[model samples]
Target: MENIKFIDQNLEKGLYLVSTPIGNLADITIRALNILKKSDIILCEDKRVSKKLLDYYDIKVQLFSYHKFNEKESVEKILEIFKKNKIVSLISDAGTPLISDPGKILINEIEKNNIKIISIPGPSAVTAAFSLAGYSDDYYFYGFLPKKLGERKKVYEQFSNLESSIIIFLPARDLVSIIKEMKEFLGDRQITIAKEITKIHENIIKGNLDNILDKIKTVVLKGEVTIVLSSEANKNKDQNIDINKEILDLSKKMKTADLAKYLAKKFKFSKKEIYQKILIFNKK
Candidate 1:
């Protein structure tokens, strides 16, 4: 094999936030490869995971483990590396670092110290999944769902009325339960589940919420899943009318402030909207 020579070897002394391939190794950018090769030391969430990528390219460099568990403690040590004027690069196990991945503490410390922080953009699961989702380009990424059912429901309720598509990360094992909760709170909106994106086993499933639930109920999903939920604008008009009627009935019995707060959570209306409606109803 011919020796691979990277261009732009004169990398500045700073912390580099490098983006790795999310699933398919070949999906990585050439610039990202060049930076990784030029890095003096690479900080990764998992050394074992990063090793495979490093080994594949025959680029030997020091690998340091800097993860959520030890991020606080690792800050001083990382800053010490920067003080040495070494080229330090941070990469997550996959995708872009700090997108639902750890690196905030170190970045904050680096910023305070006035150390340069550079970004080497590449493959990101969030953008990759969304590109294939076929939903509205206007979307909001809601990282990972909460573990507790109540907490997860609160998240769903909070974003239930968002007019743009919602993208969320979920473990395959909990897909069924999460889908059920989404149906209960978000109604049967269109959904797209992108699994193992860019890999050989990559699968894209598109359907309404109810249909998606029924399809995946019997099957087992192996990798982490990215789900895209259609915006509230796609919901049935009759459903919104029913919720409005319910809010009006509650307004008759509950105080303006109390009804506004309660209905805001149960329905999609803003508290201010509900409050104004209650005031209007009381006048009649």
Candidate 2:
């Protein structure tokens, strides 16, 4: 156990967005532990969830509920604490804050008051998944994919053309369906699915979309899954594409959404961005 004397007693009166362990309790850093122990107040996404982490360390501080629903109300209270030069630490239920979690709005409000913000970074799902997903020179973090089938397909379509790895957080319940759609839109692209990372039942599966689909057909996933799709799209992408000519030819024959999906897969451009272009072309 690390001593509390290591913690800086002079921590400024501001918000500290601290990163907690995603699954394993031991993954918490010494510095992070010290901050949690030393902070005057801890603002957690959920008190029950955060209590587990705090109980494990036997370090208790003033905890307040400041999640998405009541963040607006919490801000004024947080500011009052700051005025008294109290150290405030913000932590998510798990992993880092503001990554598919609340804290963006709170941070913006904190900055308005010229409060000092510190980052006590530790464990994160993105970096953890990437580490297990093998080597990829470039990667894009899409956070969470759209829940609706139509919107999700468009998202898969837009990113399918990228020559860089794509990372996404998806519910385990929707894993099979999402993988099926990926196979349809992204072809047999290689992917890595890391689930329950750092936990006892940690599973990391890596294969093409078809391979994953077949393997997951029988098994039921229990936890949220983080996916990493390796890039193998095109070595010579958009080099032969004449944007205007292709738009002119396809625009007349295809619907706007269809055209956007087709062009996104073909040119490696964003489906949503291409759809915006299609709208302008129709007006013209």
- Please report the candidate that would top TM-score against the real structure: 1
TM-scores of the models, in the given order? Answer: 0.83, 0.79
Task: Please list the C-alpha lDDT of all candidates, in the order they appear.
Answer: 0.83, 0.81
Candidate 2: Cα lDDT at 176: 84
Give per-model CA RMSD.
4.7, 5.9
lDDT of 2 by residue, 1-284 (tens): 44434556666667888999999998988888888888889999889999999988888798999898997877888888899988889999899888988888878988898999999888999999988887577788999888687898778767855768889999899888788777666655678899899998888888777577776665568769999987755222443246556887889898888988887677654556567667877899
lDDT of 1 by residue, 1-284 (tens): 03555777688889889999888877777788888988889999999999999998887999999999998998988888888889999999999999999999888889999988999998888888788877776999999998998897678767765789999999998888888778766666788898888888787888887678767765667769988888877666786687668766776687778877787566644455456657766787
Clashing pairs in 1: none
